[model samples]
Target chain A: MRILVAMSGGVDSSVVAGLLAEQGHEVVGATLQLYDHGAAAAKRGACCAGQDIHDARDVADRLGIPHYVLDREQVFRREVIGDFADTYARGETPVPCIRCNQTVKFRDLVALARDLGCAALATGHYARRVEGPDGAELHRAADPARDQSYFLAATTRDQLAFARFPLGDMPDKAAVRAVALRLGLAVAEKPDSQDICFVPEGRYDSLVARLRPGAVAAGDVVHADGRVLGAHGGIARYTVGQGRGLGAASWDGQERLYVAGVDAARRRVVVAPRGSLETGTATVGEVNWLIDPPSEPLRCAVKLRAREAPRAATVAWDAAAGLARVALDAPGIVAPGQACVLYDGDRVIGGGFLRAPGSVDRVPAAA
Target chain B: MPVLGLDANATEPLRPEARDAVLRALDQPGNPSSVHAEGRAARRLLEEARAAVATAFGAKPQDIVFTAGGTEANALAVRGLAPGRRVLLGATEHPAVLRAAPATAETIPVLPDGTADLAALEALLGAGGPALVCLMAANNETGVLHPVAEAAALCRRHGALLHVDAVQAAGRVPLALAGADSIALSGHKMGGPKGAGALLLRPGIDLAPLIAGGGQERGRRGGTEPLPAIAGMAAAALAARPEAAIRLAALRDAIEVGVAAAAPEARFPGRAAPRLPNTTSILLPGVAAETQVIALDLAGVRVSAGAACSSGKVAASHVLAAMGLGAEAGAAIRVSLPWNAAEDAPERFVAAWSAMRDRLSRRAA
Candidate 1:
């Protein structure tokens, strides 16, 4: 069957194409041109998409498969980039890679793949799509360290059915790159993209300021107990758990203060002791259940962010209010706008965006 | 899947005559600038090519200045102008002319059908000091013919200079360059190899060198010419038949007829306007040209969208926008039938395009 591989001019995707082609599948490559490269290339710390398009095309050519560079700047800006800024403006930490994976990489590419008459859309994502008795099942990649299932929590069940991740079984990134080198791919030694793909300079605050003006509005640094500690340049610069960059509120009475909450409309960064930052429960919205909702409260492990282990939790889905109430066994900093992904062993159960600190009040009495 | 090439405007496949000329010329040695016996042989080949291209465009051999490509030819004509001469460019002119002209140069608008608004040109000329009017003989996107002769007549009345970019029109249409002071021609556009193009000036016209290297092409353009490419271009020019342009019109129309019927909402922009017989710009609503190009390419039918940048991303065509196609600008894709486009070419393209359209529509529904 013909497969449309989303080759991002990187080694992992390049190796996926090589492996698929070696398996005798008709593999076609596509790279999305998400932004203007001319100005992008001129920037001091550019996350070079310009060179990637060329590399992807060269890899496709070497593999004797046709490659296309699709312009998705308009769509990408609206769906991924715009959402990224809005999430920050609301005083929530956002995983831009999650948003990109959910929207641009999976949702859009899957549609494009179908339109091009391809049977499946393959990606470089490190997550497995297991064919289960119930159509398809999403699972954590075999390599625990490289598991990206946290970022792919929002992937709909239908999307998973049509998507393939050949690299999901690879033991490590080095093994993938070795396959690429063995396949004679040019990007075999290309460095893994480290920072936010769009935020090349790692200046997250500046980007948020530009996209959602006034997101970086100057505000006060206050304690959780209503004590005005000092002044802060912007609440957007402070995430729920960050301890540094609070200026005068970096410490309170010889105790280091961590960011407890960010109130955007109130224009304040609430700082306090590390103990105050812990949350016993998190309210998540826009829940995407990969499995059917559990009838009784389901006991599971949940991850609140990438690079963190899933903590034991009890998650109750209130379908009427379109929200989920998660109670962690041990308190952790449940940052608003961070993803709350429910896991059952190695399988993704469901996920949703963490609700803001104040939003817990809006939860219906039905829950 | 059998692959079919349909993107003639981007470039046509090299003609056999051009291929043979290039191979035969490659055997000869010596720069045209040299004074040796081999040098004279190279010079003769160079001048013969110059005369052939000049005659093809109805100009003297001395008027033709060889440059790199259509872009350089345009840059050479538009840049280094006599001081204080106001440069007025057509809004829909190719970027080669659009960017080459001065940043402060004024623009003349175009009609809805993608034709150069001659009335606007006359007004701009009438309102100005001695001006240089830059317009294409045919649009690269829609292939709509500009009113070059009429615009030139207005320029004559205003005592202005008229420069025509005949990159698309040189071989496809009759060379009625009488009123224009200079014209640009691209070899690749006419089935010749790239890296060779010429800017034809009237007998008395001359400009400062864009490249000041060892004096070549009478110092108008410097750099030793690529002999083989120049020969290929000359051979292509000699082999191009005016009748083929007329024949391709039916094929072009057949494509329009089939595509329009299959997808009624698809706007065939320049269909009614006088355009190159081999071109069609169709706007299929709800589908971006980038998607259409990719879909068709995957189906083994090749075409292109608006002038792609170095990175192959299809930006909304300024030409379509200038013509007031508003929302449909991004929807337009150029499907230019090659010189050797077969009778079944249109059917194959329309079939692939329509199937892709139907699938997308179904998915949307």
Candidate 2:
């Protein structure tokens, strides 16, 4: 089979290409030029793509597989980056990685793979795709710490059908490095990219402010009862259940305060006690079901954030309104704009983005 | 299956004559500038190649300045000549010319047929102070031939200097450098090796050197000459015959006609214009150029679309866009026949392309 591997000039994807090539599968490596690396480097005098692209080309040359860099800067800006800033401006913490995976990595690359006469599009994502009786099924990786099923839950059924994840079954990231070492790949020791690919400095607040200035306006941090407690530099910096960075508003005399909700229209960060931030139900919109959309309430485990473990929940689907109401068995912190990924055992049933509590329509942008 | 090589405009396959000349030149080891016996031999070889190139291209031996390649030659001409004159560029010029042009340079538009809009050029030339007008003899992507002779007449009337980039047109066609002040040529684009290119200057044209290193090529360019590549280039130029254009044009037209027959919706940009004999730009209505190039490669045929970036990714063609191709600019792929292309290349290419079209169209629907 001819496979198109999305190489980010990293160890995991490099290992994926090497392993696939070793298995006698014809592999083509493609890296996305997501933004103007030259312009970005000029802004801070930083060298980023000059190394990554060279590394990718080096690895491809060593493996004897042809590699190309796809220029997706325009599409990435419009789809992922713009959506990311817009989500923040609307008082929701954005998962840019998910947006990139959903739009550019999975959707666009899958189409490109077909256009290039490839059997499937493969990547280094630590998520599994199993062949179900009906079709391909998205599942969590064997390594729990590295499982990226939540970030990939939004991949469409057609995309999942043509997607391959060669690194999903690895015992851990160390094992992936071991495979790289075994393959004699130089990228085995390349430090794993921890920050968002575009945010080289890991200062997303500054990036959001630069991209959408209206989202960074001064806002009042207030108590849930409407008593103004303190001022914040921007509402974008606050996420539900975050207790730190409240400064003088860290405590409300008897109890420590946490961000409960953000009111973008009013430019207010609503703070409350930790207990008050927990919610029994989270309304999720833009639902994508790997399995069939259940006509009845489905019992499953729901993860409300990337770092959190899945908790027991019952999800009721509202097909007409395109929303899923996830009722957590125990009240937990449900942050708006974070993914509400529902899992049954190790398989992802469906997922969607959580909406702000008590909001009817789409979350309105800041005034 | 033998891979059909159809991307001549990107870089032509080296001729046997050029390869032999390069081999012979490589055996000699002395700087052309050294004053010893070996140096005298090397200098004799260099001057011989220079004379050959000058005679082949209708220039004087002293007028030819060798540079790294087409890009450097263009930069030397545009930057060297544009100190006191306003720069005017053809809209469809290659990045070599475009990037070297001053930011304030005005663009001359092209007609729908991909030829330079002479009216626009005349108007711009008439509107300006003394200008250095840059135009390409043949567009790299579309192969559209600009009327350099006519444009040169217009430039002369306006007291402007005309520089024609003949990188693609040099070996394949009779160059229209009449009354033009300078011409740029690339070795690789004309069946020679990659490292050598030349800027031909008209007598009395004051050219400031792009590189201020050791005084060479009459102080018009600098650095030690790449003798082997330059020798190969001169040999290739001497081997090229203007009569060969007829044979290549027949093959090019066959590919275009066969492809149009196979895929009726296919549109050939610059088909009506006087284009380079070996180049054809095929535009498929709804398919992307990148996809077409890849699909063709997978099917054992090699073609190119637009300008490939440093990362080897195909970008939308600025040449086709300048000709008002609109969305078709991204959908066009250039099929330029090399000097030694197989007689059956057109059949093989058409077969592969139509099969790809059928598969992609079904998927698109």
lDDT by residue (A1-367, candidate 2, tens digit) is 9999999889999999999999999998888878867665556644334577778888999999988777788889998889888888989988989999998899889998988889999999999999999899999999999999999998988899999999889999999999999999999999988867776577777878989887888989999998999999888888999998888898989789999999999989999998888989899987888988899999999999999889999999887777888899999998888888999999998888989877664632111
lDDT of 1 by residue, B173-247 (tens): 787779988899999888899989999998898799899898798988889999999999988998888789878
Candidate 1 residues lying further than 4 Å off, grouped into runs, are A41-49, A360-367
Model 1, A4-72: lDDT tens digits are: 999999998999999999999999899988876655445664543578889999999999998887778
Candidate 1's chain A scores what TM-score?
Answer: 0.95
Checking candidate 2 for backbone clashes, the offending pairs are none
| Residues forming the 10-long window of minimal summed lDDT in candidate 1 chain A | A358-367
Each model's number of backbone clashes? 0, 0
Alpha-carbon local distance difference test for all models = 0.87, 0.89
Instruction: Output the number of the lDDT-best candidate.
Output: 2
TM-score of chain B of each: 0.98, 0.99
- Which regions of candidate 2 are displaced past 4 Å? A43-50, A360-367
Residue B14 alpha-carbon offset, candidate 1, angstroms: 1.6
